[model samples]
Target: MPRVGGTKNVDVAAVIALRPDLVLANKEESSQRDVERLIEAGLPVFVSFPCTVEESLDYVETLARLLHVDAPPRPAPARRQGELRVCAPIWKDPWMTMDGRTYGSDLLSWLGADNVFSDRARRYPLAADVAGAPAADPGARDTRYPRVTAEEIRARGPALVLLPDEPYRFDETHLEEVRSWGVEAALVSGKDLFWYGVRTAGALERLDRALAPHR
Candidate 1:
């Protein structure tokens, strides 16, 4: 595979130069402008945006069909029963977490873990997401990942706080900080929590095991 560019700012010209059979992108990861540019340049682009584990499996099947390859076996549904209240922060500073509509949230849900911020929506104007500024109309903004305050997190009262090592690279220090909140916390693989497709099954197994002790 050749290096086209970063996820959010793909080099359209470079992609066009390669002239591949098909281009795969994620709606959230890749920029819409780049995808549009590729399409305008007569390149086939398939954009995926799966919000749940089941939808991700569907995306896998769709890709296999598009590439004329056999689809891999799907992972079994979560075997657990009860739900564990969890807060998996993707970033710090202002602190951000995924809502129920996001794939990461659904992934955690599959492992019998409920995201504490599932009902929260990202407020527009960014400032509104942090400082207590007024939020934009819901119809005008994307409302998936919400910026939250530490106080708000404490209010949610998550039983366990999962710290993924990506997007923000939560380390031992961050883990200790989260533990200081007086809740059970653990460091987890960011890819397992965020990435989908072929890794989904393995991610499910790994996360399931990781959450087992807490549950």
Candidate 2:
């Protein structure tokens, strides 16, 4: 069934009514309170927190083992030419990006692209700084996905910008705007960059093709 909302806002009644034997949750996406509620109601919930690329791969294998299902062959991503300096924004309104510790960033590295903010302290950085201005909340970790500003993006001066399709859809309009800033930009599938396991192989191929123009 189509999940009406995100894991944090899933339909509890609908899920319980389905009478599923096991519930798969994520430490980052699913709330602890929700997991506990499901557990109290006699449901088994398996929570996963796959922050890095390798960890995400491991998470799938672990899940398969738990379910006693045959795991698919592991994906092997071909390495790319480590030349592009990339800035990938996942959201807008208050721009957000994947930092060094995130699965997406790891994927970017695996593809041979260097994330400009990989050394950033937060996994998701709030580019509160605009037009080379200072951040209003430099140390705020209130949300894993931090907010950013356009000026900050310019200041970072990345050679390329990757805009993902989900969490916040970055369409052609967004792509043009990024290009206007004198940086090469493209729309990318969030799943390919963020999802691991069976999807990793395809993601690698897609990313390679997407970045070919800039190479």
Count backbone clashes in candidate 2: 2
The C-alpha TM-scores of every prediction are 0.95, 0.85
**Candidate 2 structure, TM-score to reference:** 0.85
> What lDDT does each candidate get?
0.88, 0.77
User: Residue 179 of candidate 1: its Cα lDDT?
Assistant: 81
Task: Summarize candidate 1's per-residue lDDT along 134-158 as a digit string, tens digits.
Answer: 9778794578989898888888999
lDDT tens digits by residue: candidate 2, 1-215:
65646777987777777878889998778878888888888888898877766787788899899889988887755566676889888878767776777878878888788888676543322233333335454453434443456766777778899999987899999999998888889898988887766687778788988988886
Off by over 4 Å in 2: 1-5, 121-144
Which one is best on TM-score? 1
Instruction: Identify the runs in model 1 with alpha carbons over 4 angstroms from their true place.
Output: none
